[model samples]
Target chain A: MRNVKLTVAYDGTNYHGFQEQRGTGLATVQEVLELCLGRLAGRRVQVTGAGRTDAGVHALGQVVNFDAAGWPIPVERIPLAMNGLLPGDVVVTEAREVGQDFHARFSARAKIYRYTIWNNRIPSPFNRLYSSFWPVPLNDEAMSQACDHLLGRHDFKCFQASGATVKTTVRTLYRAEVIREGTLVHFVFKGDGFLYNMVRIMTGTLLQVGMGKASPDSIRNLLESRQRAQAGPTMPPQGLCLEHVEY
Target chain B: MRNVKLTVAYDGTNYHGFQEQRGTGLATVQEVLELCLGRLAGRRVQVTGAGRTDAGVHALGQVVNFDAAGWPIPVERIPLAMNGLLPGDVVVTEAREVGQDFHARFSARAKIYRYTIWNNRIPSPFNRLYSSFWPVPLNDEAMSQACDHLLGRHDFKCFQASGATVKTTVRTLYRAEVIREGTLVHFVFKGDGFLYNMVRIMTGTLLQVGMGKASPDSIRNLLESRQRAQAGPTMPPQGLCLEHVEY
Candidate 1:
């Protein structure tokens, strides 16, 4: 069997995250890839992705992997075939053969996610569905200062969603910064791993700090508490995106 | 009376067009804006846009002007108020007081429109609704050369829709350029005016040239013919957008 790695991009507006559920709903990226691959390889093939973004979340650099029996098709031709089979919203940007043991999720050294907020008093028509529109003024400096406390390894239970089934709540954050360009504010995070809705909760906490609803010190205390109730409300899924993954 | 200028944006996926129509096949952006404005002004207010875009076409910098009979609301508050009433797809990006002479259409000096094509083999999920996805390989150089032939004033009757009721077929094109950034090709046009379906037709012709189905010189001959039958196929409206208007 040969392992193939794919760099993918998707508009997550209509998806139920990246995984396949048993019941009928909108199709997920994983299911679409598996079906296409199965057809191409003439057998059942399962595809796994680096991360699963929630509904309405987008991605630019999502990674996926699958093993296939020896096929006559060239590696470069796989994307072309997938394009013909898959729907428009999920695309393989790049694909290549990888080491036999390469794992799309486990081999990743770092992952980056970006959250966008339209900060103008008026929301934009084109961006209305893709970005979060918040009319209130935000203080980027305060938000960045609060984010500094989040860098390094920490038990992020407070920022995690309640349904996360992982044994350990510990995650290492490489960088967390909030920056503004024009009327848009971007929250960028580089991390070893993220819990369910962790980035969304962190964004909400940072937004509160930026809006002066919470103080910077609150993040430190919130992290220490390890209680989901201590963190700010989870931001909506539409504004978030899986930006990149490094393997 | 006060004149208000609005910079509007919208996702055209669900709209009939920018102008209101007789029946409710799909909502027009004008209908949404008028309804929202009527609520904010507490009186009937009609909005006049820079121009009309076809059904399923989007906009980033569509301008509009409206006259109101009461004390004008603060420009800063207009976006918030309009957003509260407008649907999720339509957004008022900017609202400011303008001279009574500031007409959205007639006073415009130039207008910019962009057509996006996803050139990669696989269609992108994030850009699926926003761009046209074609699996065919496009020669960007050939498309750019073809666009160069369309950069001046000409009779655009061949590029127009057959049922259009416009009085004149002559229009000056300030710029018609095809630019490629990575796998996406952007067809940008700056013009004094456009015939109905002119941009889409131009896109279709250029796409044919890029695919080597037609020569770059063919565009010049087609424009000179002034017969709609000589032009290329009319492209889908979903890939087109009113990018901006300069006054």
Candidate 2:
């Protein structure tokens, strides 16, 4: 059996999420990709993505893998063929053959995400779909100071959404920084793994520091508290993007 | 009587064009501005714009003028008030009382237009609405060489689209250049005025030169010929943007 890995890019504005729901009838990136892959493979095909991004979250370098044992088409040509069948919002950018044991999700070592905020009095029409508009002024220094508390290993229970249940609340954050480019403020995070809505909650908390609602050094207490209510509100999904997956 | 000049910005994706159609029932930028101005003035209002951009063309600094003889609101407060009534796609960025004799169109010394081309194999989800995607390898040198021939005054009837009647086909191009930034190729043109579909056609011809379909110096012959049939096809309007209007 040949394992085929695909690098995908998609505008998730019209999608429910990355995962395939059984009977929701709502469009999703996974289902659309599986449908196209099935057509190319001449059989039912299941795709395993590196991460399940929330609805309205975009991705520039999402990774996925599928078994193409019986497929007649070469792995190199898969991207071109599948792009023809996929919707305009989703595109298969690169495809390659991998080891039989290679897995899309389990084999990932790290993932980088970027959250964009348009900090302007008036929202720009060009960035409406991709960025979250925040009219208030943001203190970049305060936000950066808050980001310093998030680096390295930590119990991120306070930043995680309440509904999800996981075996452990611990995760390793490799890098966390806030960068400002013109009117756009980018919050970039690279981690071993992220809990449900962890990045969004962290972003909201950092923004609160920028807004003077919270102290920059308060993140240490929030993380130690392990209470979801102690963290800031969850930011919206539209501003989040899966930037890259490092194997 | 007061002549109020306003700086406008709009994402023209949803509108038919900047000019209002008599009976087409199509929404336009002018009509929307007039509707809001009329509401603020408590009477019918007409707006004259510096440039009548085509459908799907964006603008960042489009200038417009309207007489506000009996308007109750002060000119400085017009933008805030009009913005409340304007749609999300259109925005009145700045409003001020101008000289009575100042006209939006006739008093303009030059206009700057920018055309963006995504010259890469993989399309960018963020720039899809703002740029034209062309996967083929473009020779930037050839395109720049072609731009050299289009500088200064010339009878550009070949670059002008048919069905537009004007007193003279000669127009002065103050600046014409092609710049490459990473995967994006930007064509910037500053001119006294552009004929209908003139910029789009010129872009198409330059792209043809880049593609090796036409020679770099062929633009001189195309201009001297004054035959629209000899020019390249008109590019789509979505890639065109009215960057600024200079007085």
Candidate 3:
């Protein structure tokens, strides 16, 4: 069996998320890749993605892996075939053979996610749906300071989704920076692993800090409490994107 | 009566087009703007836009104007009100009182349109629905040379849409540039007036020139022919945008 690694990208507008769910009536990046690979291999195949993003969460560097035997088509032709077969919103960027033991989810070392906010009196016309537009002025300095509260390894149970199945709630964050460029604010985070909805909850918390509703020290206290009620509200998923994954 | 000038932006994915048409239930940006103004003025208000962008065409700085007596809200509140009332894809950026004589369509000195082509082998997941992704390699130098053929005032009948009512198809093109940046190929054109579908047709012609299907001299001959058939195929409208209107 030849294991192939793919660099994938997708507009998650119509998807219910990255993973395949029953009765969702929604197409997923995993489902599409599996079907395409199944057709190419002339057998059933399962595609494993690096991360399972929520519905409407976009991705630029989503990775996937699948194994097949005796495939007749050339490796380069895979992208062309997938482009023709897959819907326009999802695309296979790069494909190459990998070691049989290389799993998309298990082999990942780090991941990065970005959340964008159009922080202006008037939201952008073109980016209205893709970005969260807020009329309130954000205190950039305060937001930057709040990012420091979640810089290293910590138990993220307060930020984790209620139904998440991770055995441990601890994760190490390498960097978390809130940057302001022009009329938009970008929240970028790099971490070893993220619990479901953790980034969105963190964003909501940071936004509260920027709006003076919560102090920067509140995040440290909330993390210590490990109670979801102590944390800020969860932000929407449209502005979040799985930017990159490293192995 | 106060004349308000609005700098608008939209994703244009769900609209029929920028203009209101008969028998089409799909909403247009113009229709949405008119509805917002009607509610704000407590009366029906007719809005005139600088350009009529086609279906699925996005915009960043589309200018629009309307006259009203005793607007209920302040000018600063206009953007927020309209954005709250309108759909997620359309937004009003700047709204202010303009001179009584200012007309959106007629008072514009120049207009700029940008046609973006995602010149990459892999279609972007987030931008696939917004941009036209072309897998083939484009010769930017050839495209730039071809743009030189359309630099001055000329009879643009070959590029105009078939149903255009204007008798004189003569228009002055102040500037035309084909630029390649990263994975995007931007065709930017500034002109005094443009015919319906003119920008998309010009993009198609330039794309043909870039692909070595036509020479730079071919554009000159096509313009002289005054026949739409002489030009290349009409490009899809999804990638086109009315960038701005000059006063």
What is the C-alpha local distance difference test score of each model? 0.88, 0.92, 0.87
DockQ, every prediction = 0.68, 0.49, 0.77
| Model 2 spans > 4 angstroms off | B38-44, B69-74, B80-85
Q: Which lDDT tens digits does candidate 3 get at residues B1-247?
A: 7898999999888888889885777889899999888877789898999888888998899999888667778887888888888777888888889999999999999999999999887787666656788878988998899899999999999998777789789999998998788998899999998988999999999999989999977888999999998898888988898898999
How does each model score on TM-score? 0.87, 0.95, 0.94
Instruction: Return the interface RMSD of the candidates, in order shown, one decimal each.
Output: 1.8, 1.7, 1.5
Candidate 2, backbone clash total: 0
Pairs in clash, predicted candidate 3: A11-B125
- Model 1 C-alpha lDDT versus the unseen true structure: 0.88
Relative to the true structure, candidate 2 reaches a TM of: 0.95
User: Which window of 10 residues has the lowest lDDT sum in candidate 2 chain A?
Assistant: A120-129
lDDT of 2 by residue, B1-247 (tens): 6899999999998999899998999999999999998888889999999999988999988999999997788888887788778887798878888998999999999999999899988777667778898889999999999999999999999988998999999999999999999999999999999999999999999999999999999999999999999999898988899999998
Deviation of model 2 at A31, angstroms = 2.4
Deviation from native of the Cα of residue A71 in model 1, angstroms: 5.3
